[model samples]
Target: MEGFLEGIWHPLIDNEKCTNCGFCYNYCPKGVFEKNNQNIIVKNPADCVDGCHGCEWKCPGNAISFPKPITKEYVIKVIRWSKAKGRNVSKDFIKYALKNQIIQQDEVSKEMRD
Candidate 1:
């Protein structure tokens, strides 16, 4: 649970496409999403918990998708956190983050608008 492992992966989101409705955030079982300035962000990307594809399946804008595979250690940490919190993470939620690439874009936009 400290290094990378094979078969581990996460979703990438497109912030431009996200409506910030919190659909992925609220639906995520592992608390993988967060809201900032009416946009969705990946607050707990390393805590995806489970590879469940619920978020990808539910996104209306198709703003979610899987990115480069992650390490098993990272995946374990994600799953461990979700279980400790009594929940399971969703793949769709991560997809929103991946498809939108929220992390870098959100920060850039936030700084510009400020």
Candidate 2:
């Protein structure tokens, strides 16, 4: 999910495979994910570092995979471009991003609450 004019990337979680271990949330570098309830949810996917894939790697369930390959350089470049163009990002972009990636909102929010 992009934030403001910056094209920020977000994480998406697969509920079916997620073990609810919370490893991803605990290991996440940025405040990107927050766990909400039993089901993992995607709250602030934009803060996720592009191509970090830390959560996905740590997931024993193999429940995580990006819809598209994400890279830190790509995110930085897209954000820089968007800022230069002065384009305001929309919520749809975020929703769309959540469609991809291996994280969820409820888990993200739950982790935040902890």
Candidate 3:
């Protein structure tokens, strides 16, 4: 699942609300945010952790936001597609999705069967 979900989920910064604070840049462990001269920008959005919202939570101006919430249907679609493409879905990703309630336990098998 290394590059499977890349560029799918990422943060969007509201420039009006952003104060050019570097908190998000420093807080993001994935280097998703970077300081560009006077402003902080989303440099490598693909590197953002799927369920992690540390940058959004740490933003002092509340400028960060995701495009949409992850849904169970979406996860199932991804799983099915991955299987069709002969990609090995990561067990850790499945566990994380299950633990986070992004996909229900029973629904995984049901979706996979399709």
Give me the candidate number with maximum lDDT.
3
Error of 3 at 102 (Å): 13
lDDT of 2 by residue, 24-75 (tens): 7777778666777765566776677653556776678888776566443344
Model 1, residue 95: displacement in angstroms?
Answer: 18
1-114: candidate 3 lDDT, tens digit per residue? 445455677899999999996899888889988899999999998888764556776789989988866678667867887788787666766776798889888898886777
| TM-score, candidate number 1 | 0.51
lDDT of each: 0.62, 0.58, 0.79
TM-score of each: 0.51, 0.50, 0.57
Candidate 3 has a TM-score of: 0.57
